[model samples]
Target: MKIEACAILAALLFHSLSVSAQQGETAAAAGFSKDIAPILTKKCVACHGPEKSKGRFRLDTFEFLMKGGESKSASVVPGQPAQSELFRRLTARDEDDRMPQKDDPLPAAQISLIEQWINAGAKFDGPDPKAPLVTLIPRAPHPEPPSSYHHPVPILALAFNPDGTELAAGGYHEITIWNPNEGTLLRRIKNVAQRTHSLDYSPDGALLAAAGGSPGQWGEVAVFNPTNGARVRVLGSMPDTALTVSFSPDGSRLAVGGADNSLRVYDVPAGKEQLVIQQHADWVMSIAWSGDGTRLASASRDRTARVYDAKTGDLETSYTGHQGPVFAVAFSGDGQRVYSAGRDKKIHVWDAKEGKEAGQIGGFDDDIFKLLVSGNWILSCSADKKIRQHSADKRELLRTLAGHNDWVYSLAVDGKSKRLASGSYDGEVRVWNLEDGQSLAAFIAAPGYPAAGETVRASTRE
Candidate 1:
């Protein structure tokens, strides 16, 4: 009976030691809610969270965590830390392979904690797996009606067709095509972008690319058949509003600048992102592709302009003399020079190859919003209520077209017709005789209030 008791005691002792050893091995086991979640929120969420899923991998919930990303493989392997991609990324020594590509790698202690959790079976006590995925996009509010009929809706962008037969003016949620010679509205392209900020006709005049978005909500680039206004493709649903879009000279690619402080180039045929350039520090307000389609110039609210390789997404040159946000940018016809203007009240010309400031036109009374290169002329419109033309080669002011009562937001030139179009904050659209700087016609783009006290339902379209 004593011998039997000793055998049982030995068995019990062995069991206790086994449990103790297991506890020692996982002494730093991480809890999903306590340790691992916070680390992910702080270190991983920006690119992998609701606003963006870089590789389609989201760390916000357990289901997405388990579903993994484009690879369709598991990110975390329960009970096998060595085999886990998450563990491998956290502990990766190579910068290019490391998680959080833009930031420093996770600390060793934090990595160890994650590894311990994976080895401990990677349990999650957060939201139920069966719960619906959290909505990443917020509900957009109903847009307010236009204030008055007498005052037109503000036009933010303008483009003249390559054939010089039609002009496109960007209005609230629509683009209006007008006969330039007759000053009559042609067709309205409706139900497109919320507020169109930029428009470009493809080189062959076959397509029109419009760029803009609801501020703080979403950004999109919509390509349309110019003849029928049929959408050819919608390229993006970016995190923030896109301010400008330009088609490459070859018409094979499009470059977009956005509030997200990045420049994205999209393949025209594939409708997929070809490259993402992340050198800008703030909102990228404008972008222009080189005449040869080899380089791209971008202006930003970060008070700088950058020129980079269009295909490689490599920074070629940075123009940083502006004291305020750079709102406009354009490449010269020859692609040898770049032009930019902004709140600094200056228009700067840069040497495309050397990246040096070639010339500048200064002394504007207010912010300059748009710049256009027509022939040898550099036409710019300003918040000071004036559209000024300057000689691109000589750096001399050629003419000042003064008719806008409010800030002029956009400018387009028709070299064939010798006509220039300007859009303004007061919802006024004015066409000018470029030769004499005379206003050929003036009309309101947006409908205004009927009279002082009479209630008039705003005409959503003309």
Candidate 2:
């Protein structure tokens, strides 16, 4: 009787131990949504995503990932990492047989996690198997900007408030507003992306919109209150950085273009996506709205400039004469023509309706970076370290502002104050007198980096 009782207790202890071990393995398994999805989406989805699928293989979703593209063999076999083709390809030694062909191999830690997941039964932990990997990933907050600068950051975007009292320049992970005339840093708005690529203020001056993001990871459009430097809302998010943003003439809509090759428009007050245009094959480098707000035009790296019907999001016309990647675009005041500039190094004017080249302005020393239409003048900045103003109607060069020491990447104009601001690759911001092109005040937009004669205060909190 004593022996039988002891045997029964031993059996129960063994069963309890087995159950605990199983639970531990289940908890230790790698999660599809949290761990595996980010790796595949960043490394593999560019080729095997909705836009293009090579070898009929796609890893955008859990269901499709296990479906095994074109191959009769299983892509991922539960409980067996050695038998899984996906795991084998990831661990393959030969360059030709390895996954993510041209790119660098996945880090060993990531590979080990994937192998552990497959060995633990490759289970689906998310709510849905067909959901896209992009949706499964949560939005992570951007890192805080440096309290003090060790080096000056390049300024890629600049803007003036509607009343022209302040100038805003893009800094690393923040936007710094400066007193335009005195060259004093007025305020710094934080929580921006790694880079702010474009900036624009609403027609009424109530809101300021900045478009930018981490280069290949995330994109965002943030709207802020110009008076207090408070972030009012975020307009859009994408898979890559948002390159440029433009507010409609009436301040009712905002159009954003990005490296993802899509044009997105959002209703200002509602903060809802109104239209998404994906006609461009490469980055939509620049975007502009017509005077009447009925049409939109975009310049792209695919060597094309396109006009679209704003209301219906339909292609109106495509201008293909640039023959190189076009970087900047602007609509004529009358909305009858579009002026675009690019690596071709000439500003081309084309009829918006006919898509035929109307005229061209030459003599630019290098690639043009940005174009702005203020009053009767068309302002352009280029890699040649010059800013040129031209007659909007005649397409003739009127004035040239030449003092920048590096490629001028951005331009902003305010007719009320007769002021123009330009940012360059050398981290300099030059504010000029719009009437005579005289340098009004120039300073490095970088906070904490004092210029030759002036000291700048570094403030990242406000």
List TM-scores for all candidates, in order.
Answer: 0.68, 0.85
Per-residue lDDT of model 1, residues 45-142, tens digit only: 66775558888888656677777788655798899988887887778889988897879888888887887788788887554553212212222432
Return the TM-score for candidate 2, rounded to 2 decimals: 0.85
Residue pairs that clash (backbone atoms under 3 angstroms), model 1 = 148-447, 148-448, 148-449, 149-447, 149-448, 149-449, 150-448, 153-446
lDDT string, candidate 2, 1-462, tens digits: 999999999999999999988766754767877888889878887877656777898887889899988877798999898999899888899999899899899999899888878877898888778866765665575688888777777789999998889999998888999998988889898878889999999999898899999887668898988778788988877767899999998999999999889999999999888998999999999999999999999999999999999999999999999979999999988899899999999999999999999999998989999998888899999988899999887877889998877788999998888789998887888889979889998888877887724533332322
CA lDDT of each prediction against the hidden true structure: 0.79, 0.87
